[model samples]
Target: MRCFIFVVFLSSVAAWSEPFRPWLIAAYGDTTNQTDRYQMGNDNTVIDIYTNLMWESGFLNVSTINLANKNCVSLFKNGYSDWRVPTVHEIQSLLDYVNAPGINEDYFTSLPSNESVLVTSSSSLQPTDLVLVVQQQTRSISSQYPPDMNVRCVRGPQRTAPLDRYTKFQYADKNFVKDQATGIGWMTESSAIWFCDQAVDLSQVWTPTIKALFSLFNQSNSPLIDEAVFSLPSMLYLGSSTPVAGENGYLWAIDGSTGLFQTVPLLGPAMAYCATVQLD
Candidate 1:
């Protein structure tokens, strides 16, 4: 009886020691290069051909499974089906250990896009995916000031006219210059606001609120203002990078004149704000 018990214990230990495997694997046609274009999906939802191929032909299936939809989850209602929306935690886990050397580069290489790279943290007990979702929710809240607070105390009047005349950077004709100091592309204010991608972090591109943009103009050649910047909606940012093929992306702009922001769908004219740090 003692020996039988010992054998069972050993089996349990072995099972526990085994590493977990992801449902998907890298199949043929998956490429890490960002320049090559290829077709994905069977046919119906045929989106544009991507430069890199993240072919999903392995143990796991890669379908657009919307976790928010009960019907979508119902489609995979079975044991060991091995398909679901990647929890924010799972996505983060993929990001954390993925960049390490000697890891399975093929798996990371086969992902749909570079933006899908995950960043996991050990401090949180919750799954990385859940953590990400919570963080995003909090960020969204912070972006827009709370409605319950008294508007007069927090709100201020918008400044009209260009705060100051400053040189703006133009990306149109491939006129690019590498600034030795901050490494950011230098440009002047076109309107009151000067919209551009954040050089420090590309994942989060920012646009200055009209108030903040005006402040920069006020500073002019003296120095830029020092404050946290806000971003336009994600749809606008994505549309700026990729041309809006079919439908225009929607965004909400705060208009201080009316004290009410308006939601509008747009294909272009989204902007970002920045500051200048003098290095001498």
Candidate 2:
């Protein structure tokens, strides 16, 4: 019944801004106004106090995306009938990358004690062919032949990230092209590799997160990013926003070829791409 403008402090993510931040800030919580975001609601439901969205704590195991979609909408949970499948980004909001199973167990205490991926509404490169999963790691799965993946529904005002509003505008000679939605300026690089300590030489260093990549870069066609800006290398990119617990200055290596990431020790001179974060 009210609105609040908040800043989402994504630990190591710097590309997200504006429209996406409102919804995303709910995930990471507002550093400016911190509170217990996830709280117990009615039976089998968890309320995100920050997002004003209720999440289905009890998950369903479905083999196909169609089944997952059907189950969420039809079932009536605690008098709420607006439940539906969540996008890959929506699922990523709940991923606690540092922990096993990758979900915060404090409020979401119903995680199945089995290795299973969660289904998302967003489709992959080929529609109906590939369905991406959101877990500790994001991987493509056969939409139809999936092995009983998990599905968690949400009931809230539906609003997607305003990522399609990428407008190329020039400001003097610097930052000639930029994604207007987010105040991030993508720096193009070739086979050059850089370390985290290389930030002193660069404007600002930020490691890409799976959630940020899932929202901004994953294109329908060939090249992962906008080819006009770059023909991105298929090598591991340096730095990650999500660090493994107990490992300081350590992060995941993003496979540029498929956008797949895994937590490993410095993947040897990763091809670097820089983005300067411009705050509003």
Candidate 3:
């Protein structure tokens, strides 16, 4: 009886584990046209071939919020003038969980150990005036006034040459995936978890694009499309397996949770995913 019970328990656990699989099955490829995958320019800027973004090699110590805003645009690096502070997601992508400094050390050699807080352009949920900040050492994030924070400027892919003509995807971080083909990066974690067919609540947080789309028609529908920085994955992007109860824990798709093509809820507790175009 004990052996039989153990076998049943093992079977139940196996049945319930909802494993995640990426939609694109092809192994990520290399940059076709770039001379090197990573290139350091004349100034303290480095280019990322995978995501096609240019990053400042180190953090800039700005004591005040006004300075942080003005710092990036004021300087010309490598003859490129269009530099802006990175978004919260963009800065977060630099963190490497397996390594110290949480970023790729090879490309970014000038990072300072004392500068812990990096300011982002994203506003926080609480008290909308505050900006988001990322803690480098702890890999934690908080939203606060940016009176004293470091600023790192970044620019989109360069126009000098073709970075890559074909589509490829690379893991920016555990939570984010970068697609070179579409030049879009996706967030893996869902905002909320729910069963299929649950109605989305309208009062929760959502990007303006998501809010507008959901206002029209949201259902277990077909032919879904993605827009802007934050939205759920489409059912088409979700794998072909139908979500099984007690298995395949629900994630908000482009529709309400449906077995087939669906859109994500505009506002709901359903697990939400985010996507953004690569700066380049």
Candidate 4:
């Protein structure tokens, strides 16, 4: 009896122990395009690929995949169901300190060859190239642009710094000198002007195209403002001790002053400078 009980306990434990299968089988359906198929390279899978690549490249620990299914809040895979669509903060985390590994362009390029077997109710047709083309287009548009500029035009009235020195304001608990950084209190079409609490130490911020920013903002729900903040085209920030003029390139500040600045690829190298005002 004792051995039998022990065996039963072990069986119960084994039953409970499950590994998380982060990957989910997703079906692509387009009623308008009349395209439906089980595509391997979808948004969720793309995100997974990025996550995996980043993790393998020593960028992250937990490989979390964002599920696109609305019906599934969270799913049990690999013995864990703590998975859900990443919050704005979580998505931001993925973007944090994202340099070297940059975007996994190679992963994107190789997607066509990674197609999985089609699983569909419609036996009349198999997945078509049109489906892949649509997916590729969507991804191309999304990955090509930055997130800041996309929402700028949609943002309400341009709150230009009427005065040189503006007061400081707080957004999401982050205090910022007003008007100094185009980043401060600027409105977007969706909401009022808000400052980013988590300002990067970098001197400039890059404004991506309005479309890019909108998609990223909507998808990630990041607290970082889409309008006004000076984001570096790439992720290069200068310290206060660094010389401002001619050291790197000239950056036009919010106060209409052009100073020496460094350029990074993250911010378009050609259009690098952004307006940053001095609060003090």
Query: Per-model C-alpha lDDT, please?
Result: 0.22, 0.48, 0.39, 0.20
C-alpha TM-score for every candidate: 0.21, 0.66, 0.44, 0.22
The numbered model that scores best in TM-score is: 2
Which structure is stronger by lDDT: 3 or 4?
Answer: 3
Compose the digit string of candidate 2's lDDT tens values, residues 1-280: 2111101101111121223234432243212123466778777798766555678876766656666677776768777766766654455566655555556666664444434454443322222223554433322221222355666776654443354544544432323234553445555544344442265554454444434444444533456556676656665553344455456655555566565455555445465454445221
Query: Which stretches in model 3 have alpha-carbon errors above 4 Å?
Result: 1-37, 109-114, 123-130, 145-147, 157-280
* lDDT (tens digit, per residue) of candidate 3 on 59-120: 66666655765776665788777676555434544554234664566777534544455444
Q: Candidate 4, which segments miss by more than 4 Å at Cα?
A: 1-74, 85-110, 113-280
lDDT of 1 by residue, 20-43 (tens): 222121110112222322233431
Worst ten in a row by lDDT for model 4? 3-12
The C-alpha local distance difference test score for the whole of candidate 3 amounts to 0.39
**Inter-residue clash pairs, candidate 2:** none
Stretches of candidate 2 off by over 4 Å are 1-22, 25-35, 49-53, 110-113, 120-129, 136-146, 157-164, 167-185, 188-197, 201-204, 219-221, 234-239, 244-250, 267-269, 277-280
TM-score of the candidate numbered 2? 0.66
Number of the top candidate by lDDT? 2
Candidate 4 global lDDT: 0.20
Ranked candidates, highest lDDT first: 2, 3, 1, 4
Flag the better candidate by TM-score, 1 or 3. 3
